[model samples]
Structure formats: C-alpha cells, structure tokens
Target: MPLLDPARWRLLHGGEAAAVEPATGEALGTFTLAAPSDVEEAALTAARAQRAWATAPYSERAAVLRRAGDLIRRHEPEIGEWIVRESGSIRGKADFEIRTASEECYEAAALAHRPLGQVLPSTAPRLSYTSRIPAGVVGVITPFNAPLVLAARSVAPALALGNAVVLKPDPRTAVCGGHALAAVFAEAGLPEGLLRVLPGGAETGRALVEDPRVRVVSFTGSTRAGRAVGELAARHLKRAHLELGGNSAFVVLEDADLDAAMSTAAWASFFHQGQVCMTAGRHLVHSSRYDEYVERLAAKADSLTVGDPYREQVHLGPVIDRGHLDRIDELVRGSAAAGVRIAAGGRYRDLFYRPTVLADAGPGSVGASPAYGREVFGPVAPVRAFDTLDEAVALAGDSGYGLALGIVTRDTARALDLADRVPAGLVHINDQTVNDEPIAPFGGLGDSGTGSRFGGEANLDAFTETRWTTVRATPAAYPF
Candidate 1:
C-alpha cells in the first residue's frame, strides 16, 4: 500500500545488510530499509574518521580516485541497473549517470597532481604564497536525478584535496550511490573513514550537515532543501555549497538549426522525465520561427515512449516516484488554471508522466508559474516565444532561479552577446542546457545555487579552501 515500504534502503557498511524486516517500514518486495536513526549512526562514525582521512597524501588520494574510477567502469552495467531500480531512472539514463561519474573521478585524478596552489615571486625577502587546502570533512547531499555522477562532483573534489567525505544521497536513490561510491573506494584501498556512504532521508542529511565534523556541505537539491542546508551550516559557521533549483531557459534564434535545436531541447527539457534541475525549464524562441519551433518541439515531446526504465526502446522514464509525478501535475494544472496554456502535456499515471511541453505562456501570469519558475521535475517543458533577443534575454532573467541557459544560433556575435546577458551559472551554445563539461564550471546565479559543481580548478575550489601563508618583511614588528 505504501509507495516506499517493503522495498527500502539498506545501510551499507553499517554492518552486513542481513535480512531483518524493519518494523512499520514500507518496501517494494522483501527488503526493508534501515531506519533514519540507524543511518545517522553510520554517518557519525564516518564523520569521526573523516578528520584524519582528510590529511591523506595527494598521491594516495589520486590512487583512490583512479581505483574508484576503475571499479565504476567494471561495474557499469550493474550500477546502471541499480540506478534504475533505486531512482526510477531508465537503464540508458542510469548508464549515463554512472558513466559521467566515472569521468568526474578521472578528471579529479588529473587534478590531484595538477598543482592547486601557486607561489608568486614576492618583492620582499619573505616567501609569501597562497595554497589551496582541503576544507576538512565534506558532506555531500546528492539528488536522484544523476546520483552517481552528481555524487562524484563533491566526492572526487574533496578526496582530491585531501578532504574526506560523507555522502548522503537522497533516500529514494541512495542504494546505487552508496554502492557505487564505496565500492570504488574499497577497490582503490581507501580506508573506511576516507569516504563513507550513508543512506537515509532528510534527517540523515540534516545530521551530517549539522555535525561539527562536517566543515563543508556541498548539496544538490530543491531550493527549500538548499535553504535548509544553508541554515544548518550557518548555525555552526560551516561552509555550505548549495546547488539548488533551476528554471533553465532554452533560447532559439531564427537562424538556429531546426533539427539540432528541437531535438536537443526535447531531450534537455524532458530528459529523465525532466527530473534534472538543469533541465530546460523555459524555452524562449524568436518570433520569426516561433510557431515552427514550437510545433517541432511539441511533436518531439509528444512522441517519446515511456513506461519501463529497463527497455532500450524507451528514452523517457518515470519521475523519481509518484509523489514527484503528483507535484508536476499540480504545477501544470495550476499554471493552466492561472490562464497559462498547457501547450503540450499535463498527464499523470501510476509512476509515469508522459513527456509534455507548454508554450506561448505569459511570463508574469502567476508571478513565476511553471513557465518562468517552479522546476517541474518531470516530463514537462514550457515554451515561451519571444520577438526580440532582448525579450528572450528578459524571459531568461524573468525567473528567480538561474541555474543554466541554452541558446541555439549560428551567429557567433549573437551567441556571445546572449551568453554575456544570460544570468545562469552555465551557458550552452547550440546544445542542450543540461550538459556539463568536466573542466568548465557549472553553477547557478540566483536561487539556483551558491557554489559551482564542475570545472577544472573551480571544482577543487568548492571542496578546498585557501590559507594565506606569508612571511612579513619585519618579523619582529607587530600590529599596534
């Protein structure tokens, strides 16, 4: 009867996950998850060990990352299937998650030896330099959209910088995350305390963030959750890296390629049932070809076959669960009622929301409706046609959230101009908004997030801190 009862999460490394039915818990079949309370203890133990682990040598950290990456590749298929079972993402999508995570690890390894700190030549006789250092034990709260890869964004960087990590994956998708991360560390010979995987709901995450041992919190979740993490971190004066909600914009100029932009927009907006925070939340098209673009996009959105995640033929998958489906439905219906047109989809069923698209909606219709705000984490993409580039740019900035923006056009000047004007953390030219490069920095500007996720040295920046080391010219002279 319950949505997440009998089929529950197993607290890995809390001990062996023996068959013991947790009382009053829900499950899909026979396995019941560990209570949130039990999960907290595991996190505490990891936190206890994180301190010393953060001091591990750079070579050692690099080895750990490389090994973890190897293990991820070795178990890619199993991990992919696990992602589908745990987070409701499709098999192909799951593979993408695992694959992308492996790349992060690989990138982190390269960064481990890439020289983080710099020592500039000082005019004085003192050796004054700045070196990037670890921020102690880090708490990574990853969502289900891209569990494995997103988890690595924090984990790899922290480990590379000699900071141990305690990853608190979203309860719905913690299984694959816990296993995928810990399994690699194990293969790489990282000690238990170096990287710990704990699975639970909000309480588990709260405990980790609020823990004194956790010096930094890198979280990826809803805006509300981001605020919660920020508040908890603030209480203890700990650093918080909040990658929150985003209502991304996809801008299409008249000269843009029809096939390329429409195809990418369809997948970018509704990919993973549109559960991605960076998914195209808004589609702003030029008036010259607005009608044609909307038609192609709507057709693309409508044609996606859904149902089973394991099916190869299915490019679309269910939202995380029925609860997410309900939320998407509510947002869509409310938008429709508020005089915003549901240009494409507002359908819901048992754990399935058909790929949907909404277009020609008013920007301020409901003070940031689904078209402008509210991340519809499902198969819903809203389109708003614009007559001028300025109108498109304004629409992009119309929302409170500005995580990512996608612009499709051939003119280099136009792309560059829009990229400068757009207020998103990430800007994609002639591609989907959801893509992330391992070397380029990814983050949001407003309610989208505070810190960044992917980049060459910036990823390291989020996990590590800078300690100014200076030798004064006059060592004996003190400030008055």
Candidate 2:
C-alpha cells in the first residue's frame, strides 16, 4: 500500500494552503483547506452515517477499530517520516507518537465490547435500566504538536461508541496527521462518509463547533482557543471536551538522586521542543540541592543536539514556525530582563532554539514572566529554590493552570502526601511530568481544561449519553 495522498482524500473543499517544513521553511505540499460550507456538509453527513452506524453490532465496530490499528502499525515508518517533516518532530518522538496512536485504537476497540449500561432495582414495582447511546457526530479539532496521537485519543473512542467524526486538524500538519488517518480508517472498512477529515483554520473550526448536527466537540489546543470553543459549545447546548494549555511543575526534593533527576528534567523540559501541553515549565528544587541540580541540568541541556529532525542523532528539533520561535525568544529575553539567571542556551539559529535553563526565576507571579505563571510552550525550564516542603508545595500549586506536576523524592510517603495536596489532575511521584498511557485518565483542571477526562472508561462518558428506561407489568389504578 502506498502512502495516502492528500489530494485524493474525501474532504478537500476550498482554497489551498502550503504545508511548510519548519526545519528549512520549504513547502512540502499544498493542501485544500475546508470552507464553511464544507464543514456543514461534513457534519450533516456524519449525523446520517452515525444514525445508521449506532445500530450496527458491537463486534463489527470493534473489528473496524482493530483493523485500523493494524494498518497504522504496518505503515508506521511512512507515517513517522511525514510527522518528522511536517511537524518538525525528531525521528524518535515521531515513532513514539505513531506507536501510541496505534495502541489507542486497540484500547478503544476493547471498550466497544465492554458494558456500557447498568440495570437497577426498581423502587416502586417497576423495572429500571440505563443504556449508553452515541452522541451522533463528534467534532475533533487537534493541534500541530503530537497531532496523530491527540486525534486518536478522541476519534477512535468516538467511533467505537458508534459516533461519526468530523476532524479539523491544524493546517500546518494536515496531510500527514489528518488526511492519512482518514485514509487508514477508510481502508480498514469503516463506512463511507463516517469519518471526514477537514483541514483548515479558525473559521472551519468555528463552523464545526456551531453546527447543531455535531453533538460533541473534543478540542486539544491553547487555553485562549479552548475558551472560545467552550463558550460556543455552551451556547449551542453541545457537549465539549477540552484539553488545553499547561505549565507543569517539576519538584526535586533534598533526598532526590541528582543523576536521575537531571535526566528526567531534561526529558520533561526539552522533548518535542517543549511544545507539549504537559511539558515541565517550572523546576522547584530544594535549597540544599538547587545549585548542583541546576549546574548538571545545564550541562545536559548543552550536550543535546539541535538540528534536522530527520537525522537519527538529533535530540531537539525546530519549533512549529518562525512566529512561535519569536514568541519563545521574547519570553526568554523578558525573563532575563527581570533578573532571572540564564544558566544555559538563550539563543537560537532560525527556528531551532537551544535548550534553555533559567536559575533563580523569582516568584514568577506576573504574566510577563514565563517561568511560573505563563505557559512557555518552548524548550525552556525555569528554576526556583524552596527551603521547605510546604514552600515547594506552594510553588507547585501557585499557577492558575493545573494540568500536571512531578515530584522526585526517595520518600514515598512524602511524595504521596504532596501529590494529594497539589492541584494538578495528573501527578507523578518518581517520574517526570510528560508521562501518558492509553489506559489512564488524561485531562486537567481549572484554566487548563473543562474537567473532562478522555481515556479508558472515561471515553464512554465523554462520547455517549444515558437513556433511562422503565417498565411495569400493569398500570396502577389512579383516582382523581
């Protein structure tokens, strides 16, 4: 089987947009962007398909998802390359994402056969039960970073639950992540028109969200965009599941092993150029080990190779675009101007920024500072020293965004205690902040998201509606 061509896909219906390579600013291909009319058409078509699909047997639905996973694994190499060129992801990271996406399909397939309802004891001489039904059409809007996996997190589960999908991926990585995914599902025997991939910008997304036929909206992007999506879904009385921006904190206690802490810190801070929502932006180290940890971490950051994403030896890749690169530079420069010590890497060559570390990044209470309060969305780690465990917990819980947090400590009891106190949705005891699995609940709290989890059994809740039923052997006599 050859790679899926974007031009031959089903949902191309508007002006063309150029897909540019972040490494060299070169055009990889031109993709058709979806218009407003296209969005509406897709939604209506999905609604019709979903009504039919929802009646299909669970075994058939699970088979389709399993086949989709098999196809993804077989084409992992080709898909991984597209991810590298289009999203500027390194070879390792791209491969990991492909594998993760494939596993998501398999996991979701299992849910199709699992129980989706319960029977309750009657209260007044009647039988009562509840059944979960599909939400009709799911609107999935994904971001450029980790597009394939993020799309699968919602799309696979929606399909398994008998819902159709209208996916609008980021214009920057449409061909590889969006178009290719639709092609795989189609080849795996999904009903025609059940899954439509619409690649476009904000207008396309808004059209999908506002469409009444689209019953559920699942979005993964920045907080600002998520807020608008949430408001629109609210007005339309549609279900909305949002996974927004994050500023995860990495706490290193006095008893932490410096070597292990350094390695985990580098991975959490610099992977995917730190564009991930769960990337660690703040490092709160105990005062006893602050200086040593900062020095070793800076050395590790300097040792990493930042170059072409296709190269096997390259550890870091370019940002998504020039505008994002400039934004990261501005944040780093502003932090420096605010007296934050730049321990290493405050420079960039084109879109490729060096892994940066800022020491003694003061309270980071202001919006202008990217250390604690703001989401950096770049490969920069800000460090702040805390003298006591209470102070460290305070620092970890300081941010308005409560997505994830990590603590490296030898004391298991203390780690559990701290995890209980932290406001983040995902907490890591002896690990980094960037951990995720297909079977775990994935979401955030507060400004980070709308508190809708999106994995394992959680998907059943997000993509289905419960219908209560009651039955009685005979009607009761009534007197007026």
Q: Highest lDDT: which candidate?
A: 2
Clashing pairs in 1: 5-26, 5-27, 6-26, 6-27, 6-28, 7-27, 7-28, 273-378
User: For residues 1-480, could you state the per-residue lDDT of candidate 2 as single tens digits?
Assistant: 676875564336778788888998889878788999999988988888888899999999999999999999898888888899999999889888888898999999998988868999876888889999998999999999998999998999999999999999998999777987988898899998899999988999999999999999999999999999999999999989999999999999999998777889999999999999999999999999999999999999999999988765799999999899998988899888888889999999999999999998867457546554689899999988999999988889887889999999999899999889889989998889998888999999988998999999999999999999888899866796
Candidate 2, residue 272: how far the Cα is off, in Å: 0.6
Error of 2 at 479 (Å): 3.3
> How accurate locally, in lDDT, is each candidate?
0.73, 0.90
The TM-score between candidate 2 and the true structure equals 0.98
Off by over 4 Å in 2: 9-11
Flag regions of model 1 displaced more than 4 Å: 1-55, 120-124, 367-371, 471-480
lDDT of 1 by residue, 177-276 (tens): 6545776676678777667667666767777877777788889889998988889899999988888988888888989889777788887887887888
Clash totals, every prediction: 8, 0
